[model samples]
Target: MKNKMTSHYAAKLLTASLLLLANYAFASDIVFICHKGNALNAKEIRTAYTAYFDEPKIVDNKALRPKLLQYLNMSEHQYKKMWEKQYFRRALTPPVVKKDDREVVDYVESHDAGVGYVAEVPHGADVEVCGK
Candidate 1:
């Protein structure tokens, strides 16, 4: 009985360790993605998506906001605070297409101009990593 209990505990520990490692790898591997042809850099993405900087280098079109903020390091409250300021200044328009990572991948795959972020390294032909 003692040996059996020991083996069960050992197995549980190994399983827990594997799960933790997998979670870490997934989080560490997540990367920002965009349309293949958008030609956007991190600064442009930040400016276009959020009012992180005033007098931001002009990028032609703006997309969704919260999703982009989620992509970046900003929390929802932080994004909202910045957005309120930008709204008063009339500096930004929210994005049209709201998509999660998989949807972003699907959209980017189909539309040449579609842009979005992913939680893992982009692998498809139409997706590009906009930021690290």
Candidate 2:
């Protein structure tokens, strides 16, 4: 009985460790995607996400925001605060928040200048990856 209990505990620990590692890998592997018609590059993607771009329709994936913030080395509070400042100063609204990658891909497919980041591109999403 003791050995069985120990084995179960060990398995649980290993599974938890794997889950953490998977989340870290996913968070670090964000891909910036845009409409096929746009030519936005990596630098522009970074600037558009961290700074400002008034042209492209920006879509923020809520499911990927934690990973995005981790990649940007920003706390959730800081991210929201920065956007608040942008709104206050330049009246630049933050990106439209979507529930997941599917919504973002759909938006980009429909909008010519749409841009967004996603954890995984949907299988049939008619979008192009512009940045890593």
Candidate 3:
């Protein structure tokens, strides 16, 4: 009876692990989008979000903010506090927050200095996917 219970718990744990892994695998669909002429690699994208880039106007989708913050290795509250500190120091402007992926894409397409992230890179959006 003990062996059977242990096996059952192990199987359940394995299933849960697999599900978490699957979510992470699919999360790679996020692509960083920027204006057609602007290009940024992953490192540059990270720097841009952290307020190191002055030329590009950063935008973020509210729906994806938490995931993007996770990608940046910070929680949402931590990110906000960091940006607030940056603003207080007069170092950089906080990123413009948008409603969703569509709005982010639209803002990026319309502004030459715009940069944002979306779940998928849309076809002919007049923006380039700089990083994933």
Candidate 4:
């Protein structure tokens, strides 16, 4: 009886562990990052992404582009169209697109007013996480 109970508990524990892993696999939080000493609120970050704020140059990781657009309540097509229109009307530059987190961190670190988003907040000293 003791052995059977132990086996049952082990099975339950394994199932729980698997569930937790699956949840973590599907859940990724995007952290907004900027050059150290440059802080921005959510509104400011949104404006920067939309090219409304030219002070901070915006960098975007291509992988998280969809997630960022969804956060802004926009589809990828709509976001591109809006930027296109803004470019024609205002000659605003689009966000700099980077391949991954490392590149983004490097860019933001080099540019004092650079801002970007990453799937996970980097542990580097050069960047500050402004929002999540």
Instruction: Give a tens-digit lDDT track for model 1, residues 1-132.
Output: 999999999999999999988756654454556666555676675566575544323221123334344455677687667767777787554344444556656665566555555555445446667754
Scored by TM-score, the top model is 3
RMSD in angstroms, all models?
7.1, 4.8, 2.1, 6.6
How do all models score by TM-score? 0.47, 0.75, 0.84, 0.75
Off by over 4 Å in 3: none
Worst 10 residues of 1 by lDDT: 55-64
Q: Model 3 compared with the native: what TM-score?
A: 0.84
Off by over 4 Å in 2: 1-24
- Per-model clash counts, in order, read 2, 0, 0, 0
Q: Per-residue CA lDDT of candidate 3, range 16-128, in tens?
A: 99988876765554789989878788888998898777778899888888678767878778899988988888668899999888899999999998899988876768898
lDDT of each: 0.56, 0.84, 0.85, 0.83
Report the alpha-carbon TM-score of model 2 versus the true structure. 0.75
Task: Answer with 1 or 2, whichever has the higher lDDT.
Answer: 2
Please report, as a residue range, the 10-residue window in candidate 2 with the lowest summed lDDT. 42-51
